[model samples]
Each structure stands twice: as C-alpha cells, then as structure tokens.
Target: MTLFIGFLIGCAFGAILFLGGATSYRRILGTLLLKDLWIIKLMATAIGVGTIGIYALDFVGLANLSVKPVYIGGVALGGLIFGIGWAVSGYCPGTCVVGSAEGKTDAMATLAGGLVGALLFALAIPLLSGALIEPLSFGAVTMPDLLGISGIWLALPFGAALLMVAFVILRERAS
Candidate 1:
C-alpha cells in the first residue's frame, strides 16, 4: 500500500515537473544562467509545501522525522559534484528521469552518467567513511535543534517565506 501510494505520488510529481517545463534542457540551462525563474519557483513551492506537510504529519504522530547525520566534508563534496553535474548536463536526477520518460536521448545519457556516479560513490563510501564521514560528523540534528525551537514553529515561517518567494517574488520571463 505504501509502495503504491509512493508510486502514485511519484507519478503526480513527474507530471508536475513536466507541466512546469522542468523536463526541458533549455529551461534547466536558463535557470542555471539566472534567466528563467520557473524551475526555481516550482522548487520553492515544492519545498514549502513539503516542509509544512512533513512537519504536520510528524506533529500528528502519523510520521516520524528521521534526520540524517551531517558530515561537512561529505556535504561540501556532494554539493560541488551535484552543482557541476547540473551545470554540465542541464539535467539533475529527477529532471533526467522525467526527460528520459519523454524519450530524450540526452536525458538518457545524463541518467546513465548519474547512475555510474552513484555506483562509484557507493563503492568509495568505505574509503570516505574515515576522511569525510567520521571526523566531521554531527549526529542527526535539524535547524530547529540548533535554534532550540520546535520544528513546527520554524517550519511555519520558513515554509511561508518559500511560498512567498514562489508565488509573489518570482516572475516567469517571457520566452
């Protein structure tokens, strides 16, 4: 049941991405170049809604929020790699999948490359555990923890701020 629900949600999300033009290489490049705000607005809305929904579920005892451990080196390296890949390929993992679904060859290649990268990272995890994961590790914590406030309290304002950015601050440029 959970798997089925997840599949349905994934389908809905993919449809949304498609409708929002996130599947387009041009759109991705425009975003990277700061000429298009559509994808940024879409992501902002998603994160805003997700933040509110996840915290609401947790508050009501319907979900358990499991925070991942933070490793500075691992995060910095991963972000650098992710940004470079996005800039070079114009397709992040999610968008690549959606583009592949649309039968885009470039997206297919990007997806293949991403899979290879993931495999390499998995294989290198053992070696990275010492240098990147342990020494810099900060046990599972969240912004609320750092600020000494309940997640719901921070989530409300943060989510609202993102929502405002998506709906009010950002405007789609004429193509």
Candidate 2:
C-alpha cells in the first residue's frame, strides 16, 4: 500500500509537471535566449518564496534543515555546464521524460545522456571530492545570518528585487 501510494504521488506530480509546461523545451530555450524570461522569473520567485517559507518554518521549530554541506564550486561549475548543455540539447530531464512519452527521438537522446552523465558523476565522486569542492553556504544561513539582521528586515530588499525582476519582465513583454 505504501509503495502504491508513492507511485500514485509520483504519477500525479508528473502529470502536474507536464500540464504546467514544466517540460516544455521551447519555454526552457526561451529562458536561455532571453526572449521570454517569464518562466525563469516565475521559477526563481517561487523558489525564493519557498526558501524563505522553509527557513521561517525551521526557525519556528516546525521543520529542520535536512540537507548536508554544499560544495559551492561544484554548484557553480555544474550550473554553467548544465545551462550550456540544456540550451544546446533543447531539453532538461523532466522535459526529456515528457518528450520521450510523446515519442521524440531527441528527447530519448537527452534522457540517455542524462543517465550516462549521472553514472559518470557517481564514478567520479572520489576524484571530484578533493579537486572540485569549495566551501558553500549551508543550513538556514541567509542574509539575516551574515548581516546580523532579523529576517523580517531582509524581506524588504528581497521584495524590491522581485519587483525589479517583475518590472523587467513587464517591459520585455511590452516591447
């Protein structure tokens, strides 16, 4: 019953992802080209809100930071590489899966490439541990932590940033 429930949840999540255009190659490509940053902005803002909410919950003793130390260098390098590869390939993991379901040959290639890449990364963990690692911000360490200000104080700047991004998107859309 537990396994069946998990399967159903995963199926539901996949359905939502597909319906949300979360797997749309064109939308992903638009982000890279800067032709349409709406999807990118939406994702960024949503993630920001999620991060703040999670931290707030953790502070209230309702949640925990359940992640380990992050490697900053690896993250930066990975993001750079991933962005380039994603732009060139025209599909990401989720999109690739959805496209594969729709019988796309290129999406199949993307999925195969992702599998092989993951396998290679797993095999290279030992070599990468020392060579590519760097100190990363972990825990609920946010601007408030570093600046010694209450989180509520930092919300203003965050709101300003979001507003600026929204303005940029609006201008882009208008022109």
Candidate 3:
C-alpha cells in the first residue's frame, strides 16, 4: 500500500514536471538571467504549499511531523555553497533532476555535481561536526512553534506568500 501510494505520488509529480516544461535547462537557467522563473516559481510554490499543508495537518492531529530548529552556522554555510553553485552552474540540484527527465545533458552534469557535493559534505561533516552539526530534535518545529502561533495560522501567510511569488513570476513571463 505504501509502495502504491509512493508510485502514485511520483507519477503525479512526473506529470506536473512534464507539463510545466521544468525539465528544460533553458527554463532553469532563465531564473539566473531573469528571463523566465515560471518553473522555479511553480516548484517553490509546490514546496511551500506542501510544507504548510503538512504542518497544518500536524496541528490538527491528522498527521505526524518533526523538524529540527534551524542551525545558523549550518544554514549559512549551506546557503553560501548552494548559492555559489547555483550561480556558477545555473541549475540547482532539484532543477537538474527534473531537467534530466526531459533529456537535458547539462542536467546530467548537474546531477554529477550534486553527487560530488554530497560526497564532499559527508567527508567534511566529521571534521566540522564540532561547529556545524547540531543535535536532532524529535518533534515538529515550525514557524508557528517557534513564534508561539498556531500552525494553521502560519499556513495562511505561507500559502499567500507562495501565491504572490507565483503571481509575480507569471506576470513577468506574461509581460
């Protein structure tokens, strides 16, 4: 049953990516050039919505969830690395995987880069654990939890923000 559900979700995502033209390196690179960010916006919205929904469900007692609090040093380091890599490669890891599905050879290179990045991280973790690795938390930790607000309450703003971003991205493409 779990396998079937996973397959269905994967298929749904595949169809979405196929229809959205997200599997193209041109579209992914467009974000850097400020040409077209439609695909990037769509993916970001999907992630934001999914995250909000999961948190909402957890608040309602319909789902289980857990999130470790943000580690500033790790977040900063990772963001710097990711930003540099994306700017240099013009394709982030997520976009690269989708592009590979649509036959982008550059996407294949990006995937290789991702693997290399992961390997390097693994290798460095042991040496950096003293300052970088934080202890894991066992239960849900979100904006609402951190701010002492309701999860569903936070969801509204998150969803709205995603919609606004999508609108802006789409509007730019339309113009």
Candidate 4:
C-alpha cells in the first residue's frame, strides 16, 4: 500500500515536472543562465509543500521522519558533482528520467551517465567511508533538533518562506 502510494505520488510529481518544462534542455539552460525562473519557482513550491506536509504528518503521528547523517565534506563534494553534472547535461536526475520517458536521446544519455555515476559511488562508498562519512558526520540531526524545537514549528515558517520565495520573490528575467 505504501509503495503504491509512493508510485502514485511519483507519477504526479513527474507529470508536474513535465508540465513545468523541467524536461526541456532549453528551459533548463535558461534557468542555469538565470534567464528563466520557472523551474526554480516550481522546485521551491514543491519543497515548501512537501516539507510542511511531511512535518505535519510526523507531528500527527502518521509518519516517521528519518533524518540522514550530515557530513560537511560529503555534502560539499556531492553538491559540486551534482551541479557540474546538471550544468553539463542540462538535466538533473529527476528531469533526466522524465525527459527519457519523453523519448529524448540526450536525456537518455544523461540518465545512463547518472546511473553509472550512482553505481560508481556505491562501489566506492566502502573505500570512501573513512574519509567522507565518519570523521565529520553529525549523526542524524535536524535543524529543529539542534535548535531544541519541534520540527513542525520550524517547518511552518520555513515552508512559508520557501513558498513566498517561489510565488513572490523569484521572477523570470525579461528575455
């Protein structure tokens, strides 16, 4: 049941991404160039909504929030790699999947590359664990935990701020 629900939600999210032009190289490039803010806005909105929903579910005892460990070096390295890949391919992982579904050859290549990258990362994890995962890891701590507050309390304001960023702050450049 949970898997089915997750699949349905994923389908809805993919459809939203498709409708929002996330599958288009031109649109992605425009975003990278700061000439378009559509994808940014879409992502901000999605994150805001999801954050609030997840926290609310957890608060109501309907969800279990699993926080991942935070390691500064790992996060920085992962982010750098992700950004470079997105800039080079004009497709992030989610968009690549959607674009491949739409029969785009470039997207297919990007997806393949991403899969290969993930496999390589998995294989390297054991070797990298000491250097990347252990010394710097802050075990499963969230902002709310650090601040000694309820997640829902922080989530409400943070989510609202992101929603404002999406709907009110970010604007498309005149092009």
Candidate that beats the other on lDDT, 2 or 4, i.e. the better one: 4
Q: On residues 1-175, what C-alpha lDDT tens digit does candidate 4 reach at each position?
A: 9999999999999999999999877778788788888888999999999999999999999999988889988999999999999878888899999999999999999999999999999999999999999989989988888899889999999899999988778853323
Q: For candidate 3, what's the RMSD?
A: 3.5
lDDT of 2 by residue, 24-124 (tens): 76666666677776666555555556556656766678765565556777778889877776777887776787777777798899889989988999999
Residue-pair clashes per candidate, as listed?
Answer: 0, 0, 0, 0
TM-score of 1: 0.93
C-alpha TM-score for every candidate: 0.93, 0.64, 0.76, 0.93
Highest-lDDT candidate: 4
lDDT (Cα, tens digit) per residue for candidate 3, span 23-112: 655676675576777776777678777868777778889876655656667778889988988877767766677677777787788888
lDDT of 1 by residue, 8-82 (tens): 989999999999999887787787788888899999999999999889888789889889999999999999999
User: Candidate 1: where is the Cα deviation over 4 Å?
Assistant: 171-175
Candidate 2 lDDT trough over 10 residues, lowest sum: 134-143
State model 1's lDDT: 0.89
Candidate 4: segments with Cα more than 4 A from true spot: 171-175
Instruction: Give the C-alpha miss distance for residue 30 in model 1, angstroms.
Output: 1.9
Error of 3 at 89 (Å): 2.5
Candidate 3 clash figure, as a count: 0
Return the lDDT, model 4, position 106: 92
